[model samples]
Target: MFDSMDEERPTASEPAVRRSRSLFEKHGLRATRQRIGLAKLLFSKGNRHVTADALAVEAHAARMTASLATVYNVLNLFAQVGLIRSLAIEGTKTIFDTNTSDHGHFFFEDTGEVCDIATDEIKFAGDLEPPEGYEIVAVDVVVRLRPKSGSVPFSA
Candidate 1:
C-alpha cells in the first residue's frame, strides 16, 4: 500500500519530477530550482484554477522561493507548452488552470473561483460559421455565476 499522499496523486509523485524535467527540457526551458518548486506546488494540488498572485502566496506558504514576476513568467511558459490552460475572465483577471483538457468552466463572480464543467456538459447545438479564410480552432465556454438575491454568501 502507498503511504505518501503524492502516491495518490500520480502527477505529483516521484515520476512527476521526471515528467516536469522532461516537459521543460522538451520545451527548451531549464529545470531550475524555482521552476521545479513551482511545478510541484501547481501539480501537487488537484485540478484547480489560480491566479499568479495566488500562486505566489502558495509558494511563500510552502517556503518555495519565487518572485511574483517569476511566477507569472513560469505560468505563461507552462501555458505556452500546453501544461496548463489560461482563462482570461472578469475583464482584467487571468486565471491559470491546472487541468489542460478541453473543457468548460464555471466562474463565480463573487468569490473569483473557477470550477471545471465536463466537456460533454455543454453541447454546441448549432454549427459555427467562420470567416472567409478562418477556421474554428476551439470554443471556450465560461459560465459566470452569481448568487441570487437574498442568497447566503460564500463561506471560506
Candidate 2:
C-alpha cells in the first residue's frame, strides 16, 4: 500500500493523500510523516469517530508508537484542515469525527460511547439566528442516553 505514484492516474489512496497534502499546505501546515500517517488513520474508515485514548491504543496496537501528544496534535491539525470535527460532550473528554457533514451525535451515558445521528432524522421548527459577527456553521445535537437494562422507561 506504500507504492509510489506515477504521473498518470494514481491509486485510490494516492488521491486521498494528495488531497490531504493540499489541505495541509493550504492551512499553512508543514506536512510531516507523523501527520500524514495520522491523517491516513483518521480518514481510512468511513463513518467512524474516536477519542484520543482510543486512537492512542490503536496506534500502539499497530506498532506505530504515536504518542498521545502527537495524536492530539494530529487531531488538531486535521480539525484545522476541515478534515474532521471535534466534539466535547458535557465538558469532558473530546471525540474526533470522520464525517464532516452536518450531523448530530448520541452519547451513551452508560458506556460513555459516542455515535453519529443523521441530520435528516431531526427537525427544528423555530426561528434560529446566529450572533452578530459569526454565521452559524453547523449544528450538533448530543442526546445523552443509557442502555435499557430491564424495561424501557416511559419517557424514553
Candidate 3:
C-alpha cells in the first residue's frame, strides 16, 4: 500500500514521497496531492500496463478521492511527459505502460492485457528505411494474440 501522504506535505525523509516529488520535478510537472497519490499507485507496483478505468478502481480501493476524469487526465499527462508509454489498441482503447524503454508488446486480444516483448525478441529481415527527409523514430510492434481451440484465454 502507498503511504497516506495525501493530507500532509511530503518531506525529504520519506523515500516514497521524495521519489514522487522528484519524478514530477524531473518531468517539469507540479507535484499536486492528487497527482502524487496517483503516481505512487501507478509506479509503486513496478512496470506494468494499466487503463484509466482500472486505475480508478484501484484508487477507489485505496481510498483515493480521484475521479475517473481526473484519472484519465493524469494518465494522459503522464504519457505526454514521457513518464509512461501509451499503447493505442482496439480502436480507442488505450493502455498506459510504466516502462518507457524501446520495446514492443504482446497484446492479448481475449483478455485485453498487454505484455512486454524485448527488443531482441523481434528482428527485421532487412533495413527498415523511412520516407525521404524523415528519420525513423521508434518501431511500435503490437503482436496480437488469442487462445487457440480448446485453450483458455489468459485472464487479466
Candidate 4:
C-alpha cells in the first residue's frame, strides 16, 4: 500500500504543495504534517466534490492513516477558511466542494454524482423576499435529476 505513497509523494517543486501551503497559511491554519498531506490531496483535485468518508478511502489507499474524524475536522477547518464549500444533501451526505466560488450543481439521484452547472445556463425570476429584519446572504441552486420514467426497468 505504501509503495505508491513513496513513489508518488509530492516533491518540493510541486505546485500543489506550494499552493496548499500558501492556502493554509493564508487561512491562519498551522501547516502540520497531516494537514499538509490532506491539503495536497484536496487542493490538487481541482474543482470537484468529496465526502469525508471518501477522502478517508483515498488516504487509506495511499497508506496514510488519518482517521475519519480527522478528515471531518480538517474539512470543517478548510470551509471555515473559505477554502471549500460544504453542502448538505438529502439530510444524509455532506459534500465538500473544492471550488469556493459561486456556482450551482446538478445532482444525479441514481449515480449520486454532482456536476457543475454554469451560471449563464440558468436564470431566476420572481420575488426573493424574506421576513422583516432578516436578510438572505446566499442562495444555492441544486438541480436534482432522475432517470426518465420510460427508462425504468421494473416497478415496485
Best by lDDT: 3
Best by TM-score: 3
| lDDT over C-alpha atoms for residue 49 of model 1 | 89
All candidates' lDDT scores? 0.78, 0.70, 0.81, 0.73
lDDT of 1 by residue, 1-156 (tens): 011222334452357678668767866889988888898888777787899999999999999889999999999988887677888998877899877655788888898888888867766424778889997755677888899999996632
Model 1, residue 18: distance off in Å is 2.3
Q: TM-scores, in order shown? A: 0.81, 0.77, 0.82, 0.77
Cα deviation of 134, candidate 2, in Å:
4.0
Angstrom error of the Cα, residue 113, model 2: value is: 1.8
Order the candidate numbers by lDDT, best to worst.
3, 1, 4, 2
Better of 3 and 4 by TM-score: 3
TM-score of predicted model 1? 0.81
* Alpha carbon deviation, residue 40, candidate 2 (Å): 0.8
Q: Which pairs clash in model 2?
A: none
Off by over 4 Å in 1: 1-15, 124-126, 153-156
Q: Candidate 2 lDDT, tens digit per residue, 26-144?
A: 66888886776676666666557788888888777777868999999889777766667888895868888877766778887766778877667876323677778977666777888
Worst 10 residues of 2 by lDDT: 1-10
